[model samples]
Target: MWSGDELDLDAYLARIGRPGGSGAAGELRPDLRTLYAVHRAHTAAITFESLDVLLGRPVALDVKSIEDKLVHGRRGGYCYEQNSLLAAALERIGFEVSGRGARNRTRGDSLLAVTHAVLVVTVEGEPWLCDAGFGYQGPREPVPLGRPGAEVQQGEWTYRVRKEEDGILVLCLLRGGVWRDLYAFSPQRYHPVDYVLLNHYSSTHPGSSFIGRVVVHLPGDGVRRALVGRELTLLHPDGLAERRVVGPDELLAVLDREFALRLPERDAAELVRMYPAGD
Candidate 1:
């Protein structure tokens, strides 16, 4: 079992833009309000990005390395790194948190791998789903896990979780006047080692989406901003989208300005070469 003492809870919370973390008495406790505050701060502060993977660097999932990367380094990461860091922060804050894997079913059944990592937290004997790693399309707060269905509203988006057959839980996002399945998972407690295999595959595999393209996402006050390769899309709260093609020369500027990423010169050059806007 991982303990919260291993991480600097105060530093972690501050890095995620939640300087005032946890209970008022100063001792971190397992509570819904704290959970929501942490989740919201993380998603808004630290972006969900795959630049390292695309740049041919090894994506380490160890707690120390993850902390350094996201906190000290001020870099963003994919699901495995993002969720792992959050889980560690929560665990150290006295929350009974467990790692879980989920299969992204948004594309189709063709991609059936446990590539997503989420946290299942038990506070007061009740389970809550907390994920700050699912790009910009996840619940903005910790959602309660229950039977039938539960809808959670975060600003302009509505997320639904429903119990499915064979003890599977399906998470869906409401979009375009329809409910789209985001991912599905079983009620199994996973650990950091469980994500090692999937992280390697997702970061290094030629078929992995995170490898060939540059994906950067940040959720804001009333909109979600995403920069995929050469396309920049701003998604409004009402499910409306506006997109435009960004030139190769302006890509790094967009990354720095909009996504708040200060990439190294080498990585910036590599991205330009890989995703040139051939106008």
Candidate 2:
């Protein structure tokens, strides 16, 4: 029962580094320009990380807690927290937003569960996809929603919206000339409570990958940086990439300097333990 009343519009804007007023006093519309501005700014400012999950803390999906954690607390989170915060902000910004459940195809092809979340927004009677989550695979700007075979190319990344035989829509990424499925979702609407259940599973279940791994992602000027259990990768748009296994001693500095996170001493020490050297 999110009334969309809990978000602090001013604080949220500051958190995303879009603190300036959008325009004159007129009500803002969900136009393409505004959507791109918000989406890109949100993705750039916030990051995709699993610090709470890694530290064995509960993940909150409510609007108040989300605002407090992501906006006021100045921290990053995974899909549920990230998209939930984005959806709430978009609603307050006057967008026709629908929260949808999805399955991560990267995890497997074995009839995956709805472990991911995304937003389908309508602007001027047309649907567009916007997500601040999805880490390195997230779009830099909102992409038009289309049927199978339709594609949107942002720099080096090529994303396609494909409709499966069962009428499920999947977002695919083209990498190294191969089309890899990112996630699959139906038009089925999802609610905040629904995400609470999904979030609990993702954070607590022993089978969940987020339970023990150190995953951090932040989009840079022209590259996406990701750290997965000490293996740091920098993927550039021009097919250039670099990777190295980072040591535990440098993990905190990387999180602070590279990802722009200011973690508490306890959290920082715990993260170092979570991703120890040679892990």
Model 1 over residues 11-91: C-alpha lDDT tens digits?
A: 787787765445532665678777888888888888899988877889988888888889888889888988888888888
Worst 10 residues of 2 by lDDT: 19-28
- Give per-residue CA lDDT, model 2, range 1-279, as digits (tens): 344567776678878887545452134456777788888889988889987998899998878888888888899999899888888878887888888898889866577788888888898998887888889867777777755678887766788888887678888877667788889888888888888899999999998878788889986556778988778899876656799988988888888887887787788877777776664
Taken over the whole model, the C-alpha lDDT of each candidate is 0.82, 0.81
Q: Which stretches of candidate 2 lie over 4 Å from their true place?
A: 21-27, 238-241
| Reference-based lDDT, residue 148, model 1 | 44
Steric overlap count per candidate: 1, 0
Q: 26 in model 2: Cα distance from truth in Å?
A: 6.0
What lDDT is reached at residue 94 by model 1? 75
